[model samples]
Target: MDKIVSFCKRRGFVYQSSEIYGGIRSSYDYGPLGVELKKNIKDEWWRRLVHMRDDVVGVDSAIIQHPRVWEASGHTATFNDMLVESRTSGRRYRADHLIEEATEIDAEGLSAEEMTKVIREDERIKDPVDGGRDFTEARPFNLMFETYTGPVKGPENLAFLRPETAQGIFTNFKNVLDTSRVKVPFGIAQQGKSFRNEITPGNFIFRTREFEQMEMEFFVEPGTDEEWHETWIQERWDWYTGLGMDPENLRVYEHPPEKLSHYSKRTVDIEYDFPFAGWSELEGVANRTDYDLSRHAEFSGQKLEYIDQGTGNRFVPYVIEPAAGADRVALAFIVDAYREEELEGESDDSRVVLKLHPRIAPVKAAVFPLTKKEPVSTKARELYNDLRGDYSIFYDETGAIGRRYRRQDEIGTPFCVTVDFDTLEDDQVTIRDRDTMQQERVPISEVRERLQRLISTGSAAAER
Candidate 1:
């Protein structure tokens, strides 16, 4: 865990948000390389979920919605985490998480009192600060961050930063139905920032007060809700593994019947093996049996039902929701793709690489010159510019080619193109594969088409 965090900071992937002022708690800023990686993951998700699927379309919702939207969605009344603080350390924590840390025991189904009782009863659990015995009582803390709307600050004008993106889709259900050509079995996909006042936000980017989410709510007929829910779970699992995630490290955890959310008839989480937290959720698939749309209809005085054209029957559509945290997915991709290999003859430094998928790598390829001198550098610049129009590329001529390759490898650039003196004689240059460390000579004119073909085939044949 420490190694991954340090690598992220040193490689310009992520940094503390307010580092100059000694930093902020659990707040982080994605650096240049980090931003590119995030964008690629998001683009791939949108490409598969929205662009490729005819039954699904995309929506970018506002960060702040009418306060009533939350009320109708039941977030205002029940969105909370059990918070407990230590008297000696003055540090607060989510009771369930703290309990999990203390006893390798999952406290998900336990109530606040139960969590407090378990912590107090267990002799192994002690105050983290100075190992003191004193602790504070557990209480429910609402996770919503509230603010005033318009020009005034009062209860009448209260608003909240959206805690989830699903509500926005629910509120716009009628708007989309009235305007679009989509039908009952269609889906509304969204990707946006969501906020929660987390009691304890730690573990790098795992749990934070602010984060991005990629969610899709598939509305289906009541009888078909369970089947659609199962289908989405498999589809989402395949999405992650298809993008180079290790299938062994990903699993579906079924939610206990008693622990399911109020809106969920059945829920299952797609969990990944995280470095610090072992197995944790990467996404959740839930069967919300008309709870959201039905609630909104009653609260907003608008009918939120879908009409079947063939049967002429009007009914509320049950929802199958697959909600994933963008931050978790990005972090998982980095951690899962990271590798360190020993150099057979070198004792000084080991080779570190991020074996990311070709389609989702931050920089698809890097262009370099074998020497910084003329013709080599000039040709490298020309090739870099030519490929820039097609793929995100890196061009370097500063240091040793080996060092440059390491730099690009650490950032998950799959292929490196080097323009050498040989290229000046024949229109051919050396293209090196990151994974296999094999080199192939190809005509300069075919570089673009070759790269396109390699990406389409996932990775170059030589990379194997």
Candidate 2:
């Protein structure tokens, strides 16, 4: 876990937020390469969930909605964690987490009083900041971030930063139905920022106060919801595996009846073998039995039901939601791609590489000049200019060719193009594959087409 975190910082993937001011705990800023990688992940999600499928449509909802939206979604009342503050360090933590970390107990459904009692009785349950057992009684702490709109600070002006993007899709359900030609079995997909006042946000970007989510709510007939739920579960699993994630490191965990959320009739989480936290939830697919629309309709005095034009039957559609954290998925990909390989003949000589999927790699390919001299550098820059418009291409002339390749490998660039003296005569440049370490000489004019094919196929030697 520490190795992954260090690599992320060293390779310009992520940086602590407000680092110049001593940084903020659990807050991080995506650097240049990080932003590109994240954008690629989101783009691939959008491509598969919205563009590739005809049943799913995309929506961009606001981060801040009306206060009543939370009330209607039951988030204002139920979206809370059991919090306890330490008397010695004055630090706060989730009571359930504190207890579970100290003992071999499943603290999923424990009440505030139960958690408080466990903390008071257990000697191992000490504050993380300071080794003190003194703590306040556990209480429910709402995770929503409350704010005031306009210039007033009253109940009427109260608003909340959305804790999940799913609610926005629900609130705009009627609007989408009226505006688009989508039918009953269609889906509404959204990707946006969400905020939560997390008491124990840690494990780098695995859990954070502010993060992005890629959520899709598929509306279907009530009777067919169970089947659709399983369908989506398999769909999500296939998505991860299809993108090169090892199937052995992924599993599906079904929520027991007692552990189910209020709105979820049946839920299954897609768990990943994270380096820090083993088999943690990377995404959840839930069968929401029309609870969201029913609640919204009851609260807003509006009918959120769908009427089948062919059968003339009116009923509220059940929802199957696939919710995934964008940051968590990116982190999983990074962790899965990390590798340290020893050189063939050189003892104690090694190189670290990220074998990311070509589509998800931050830079598709890098352009390198053999030397900082005139003709080679000019040729490399020209090739770089030509490819930059189509892909995220890197141009580096400050380092040795071997060092340049290592730099691109560390940052997960799938291919590297080198312009050498031979290129001045043969009009061909050497393209090296990061994973296989195999080189191919292709005409300079064919570089873009070759990269396009390799990236699209996610193969090092697709044409070969």
Candidate 3:
């Protein structure tokens, strides 16, 4: 965990938010490379779920909506976490998390009083900050961030920052149906920011107060909800592994019937193995048996019903949602790609490599000039410009070729293109692959075509 954190800071992947103010508690800001990597992940998701599929379309709704939306969605009353403050340091934590750390027991189902009693009785429990024995009673803390709608600061004008993108899709269901040519068995996808007032937003960006979500709600016939739910679970699983995630490190956890969410008929989480948490959710696919649309219809006094022209049947559509956190997905990819391997025939010598698939790599390739001399630098810059129009290319001329390659490897650039003296005579450059360490000399004009095919959808380079 320390190694990953250090690498992230050293490589401009992420930084603590508000660093000048001695750094904000659990908030983080993505750097240049981090932003590019994050964008690529989102682009791929959009490509797979929206653009490539004919049945799914996307929508972007406001981050702040009518307060009645929450009332309809049940977020106001149920979106909460168990909060307990430590008497020693006066720091707050999620009681369930605190309980797990102290006794290795799952405390999510416990009542507030039950959790408080356990905290008081356990001698092993001490404030992690100051190691004091005193503590406060557990209580429910609403996760929504409340704000005033306008100049009015009264209860009637209070509004909330959306806690999930799923509600936005539900609220806009009729608007999309009326505007678009979409019909039943179609989907509405969205990607946007969501906020939660987390009690313990630790483990880096794995948990945070502000985060982005890529969520899709697929509307289908009520009777077919379970089948579609399983179908989406399989598809989401393939999505991660298809992009080079190790299947062994990913699993599907089916939610027990007794513990399912209020709106969920069935829920299955796609868990990824993290070094810190062992295994945690990467995404979730849920069968939401028409609860959302039904609630919205009842509250809004509008019919969010779908009339099937083929069967001439009028009814509300069931929903199957596949929701994921962008931050968590990026972390999972980074952790899975990190590797430290010893160099061949060398003792106490090793190299760090981020073997990110080309599709998700921050930099697609690095262009290098053999030396700072005129001809080499001139040719390399031209090639860099050509590729930059199509891909993210890095141009570096100040370091030794081997050292530059190592740098690109560390940041997960898939290939390195070098312009040497031979290039002036043969019109060819040497291309090195990051993972295999194999070099291929190809004509200058062919680099673009080769890389395009290599990184194209479902291509070999993308899968690797």
Candidate 4:
């Protein structure tokens, strides 16, 4: 974890928000490298889910909605976490989290009374902050952020910021259907920001107050839901693997009957092994049935039915939802790819490298000149400019040739192109592979094609 944090900061991957003014807790700002990496991840998701598929369309929905929406969704009454206030130190904590941290046990589905009893009656618990002896009674804390529409600041204009992106898709289902002329067995994919007032929003960007979600609601015919649900589960599973996430570090956990959401008939979470948090959810693929559309239709008094063209059947469509936190997935990529290897015959020359797959690496390849002299630097910059339009290219002329290779290697640049004096006579450049450190001399005319093939197929066979 420390290695990742230090590498991210040193390489300008991510930074603390408002650091000059003592920084905001649990809030993060993406640096240059981080922004590019995040954009690649998001673009890959859109390409695979929405662009590549004929059945999935996309929509952008508003961030705020009417208060009644929450009521119909059961969030007003049930979407809450148990919390407790420390009597001695006057600090508040999520009751379940405190219990779990102190006793090293999970209290996920426990009721408020159960959490309170566990905190107060359990004698093995102790506070890490002040060495406090006991805990206060537990209470429920609602996480919605309330705001007003008009200037009056009254309940009449009261609305809430969305806690998840799926609700927006539900509210806009009819709009999409009417415009796109899509039938049942289709989907609406979305990528947007959502907010939650979390009590303990630590662990970097894992559980932030404001974050982005990439989600899809695959609406299907009623009786076909179970099959489509399983199909989408496997499809999404394959999508992650295609993006180069290690299969060994990823697993699916089926939600138990008691652990499922109120509307979810079935649920499975894709968990990733992070350095600090072990196995935590990176995405949730659930069979949400028709719960979202039904609730919204009942509350808003709108007909959200899809009529079958062939059978003339009119009914609501069941939804198979795949929800992923963008930040969590990005952080997982960094954690999974980070590596520090000891160099041969040297104690202090150990190397740090990120073995990121080329598809999502921030810089696809770096171009370096063996010498910083007049013609070498000029020629290298020209090549850098040419490749910059097609790919993210790194140009370094200030360091030794070997040092430049190490710098590019640390950030997982797949290949490094070194311009040497031989290029002046032969019209060719030497390419060094990051993983193997093998150098090959290739003509300048073929370099672009070789890079394109390698970046596309991720194969050293391109060099053949």
Using lDDT as the measure, which candidate wins? 2
Per-residue lDDT of 273-349 in model 2, one digit per residue for the tens? Answer: 98689989999999989999999999899999999999999999999999999999999999999999987863337
Residue 278, candidate 2: alpha-carbon lDDT: 91
How should the candidates be ordered by lDDT, best one leading?
2, 3, 1, 4
TM-scores, all models, native as reference:
0.96, 0.97, 0.96, 0.95
Model 3 over residues 1-464: C-alpha lDDT tens digits? Answer: 78888899899999989998899887999998999999999999999999999999999999999999999998988888889998778899888888899797778788999999999998888888988878889999999999988888999889999999999999989999999999889999999999999888889989999999999999998898888888999999999998889999999999999879999999999999998999899999999999999999999999999999898999999999999999999999999999998888633367789988889899988999999898889999999988996878899998678788888989998888999999999999998888877788999999998777766643334435
lDDT score for candidate 2 against the true structure:
0.92
Stretches of candidate 4 off by over 4 Å are 345-349, 459-464
The segments of candidate 1 whose C-alpha lies over 4 angstroms from its true place after superposition are 104-106, 345-349, 462-464
| 1 against 3, candidate with superior lDDT | 3
- Prediction-by-prediction clash tally: 0, 0, 0, 0
TM-score of structure candidate 4: 0.95
The global C-alpha lDDT for each of the candidates, from Candidate 1 onward, is 0.89, 0.92, 0.90, 0.85
RMSD of each: 1.7, 1.5, 1.8, 1.9
lDDT of 1 by residue, 14-119 (tens): 8999999999998999998898888889999999999989999878889889888888899988998898888888888788877786788888878888888988
What stretches of model 2 exceed 4 Å from their correct place?
A: 345-348, 461-464
Q: What is the lDDT of residue 370 in candidate 1?
A: 93
TM-score preference between candidates 1 and 2, better one: 2
Deviation in angstroms for 288 in model 3? 1.3
